[model samples]
Target: MTLEARLAALAAAGQTITYGKLARDLGLRMEELTNALERLMEEDAAAGRPFRAAVLRQRLSPEGLPAPGFFLKAAILGRPAQDPLAFTRAERHALLPFPNIPG
Candidate 1:
């Protein structure tokens, strides 16, 4: 499947997916997935849309260690919605570095 198709499929599933898992599922290297995501983000920005790829780190467990891993989900911005799993402000700042994006 094409990268766009894979992204659409994940968005349709409405679930966040770890990079490692997504890479394996897509038969792509981890770096390939990351590069694709970066390209997608750039495309979205150039089109005057809020980035659709939300990259977030998994939450920690009671032991204060992450339970799963870093993940990304496709989302529509500028809409009335809630992502309980959305990354914290600090996390977004740390993960994304788009100059045109507002926090």
Candidate 2:
């Protein structure tokens, strides 16, 4: 399946997939999958999609150290990652429909 299709599928499934999982799903390398994500994000913006690029951070436990499953706690459409807590729920909602995001 195409990268767009892959991301759309995950969103439809309401899954919080990791990079390795995404790579496995597409039968691509980690770097390639990461690139696809970037491309999808660009396409999302170019298509005038309101959803911006962001990472999904679902806490594994109620407490303890951060998990290593995801790349970062939070990130936006631009560079320089930021913590998810800094973003409001509404802002995160704005990024919900973008590539590789679950509904």
* Residue-pair clashes, model 1: 0
- Candidate 2: list runs displaced more than 4 Å: 50-103
Residues 1-103, model 2: lDDT tens digits: 8766655554444444545555677799967766666666566556755322233333453322223322231234442235433332333345445535553
- Considering summed lDDT, which 10 consecutive residues are worst modelled in model 2? 64-73
Clash count, candidate 2: 0
Q: What is residue 13's positional error in candidate 2, in angstroms?
A: 2.7
Screening candidate 1 with a backbone cut-off below 3 angstroms (N, C-alpha, C), the clashing residue pairs are none
Against the reference, the lDDT scores of all candidates come to 0.47, 0.46
How does each model score on TM-score?
0.51, 0.52
Candidate 1: deviation at residue 12, Å?
A: 2.5
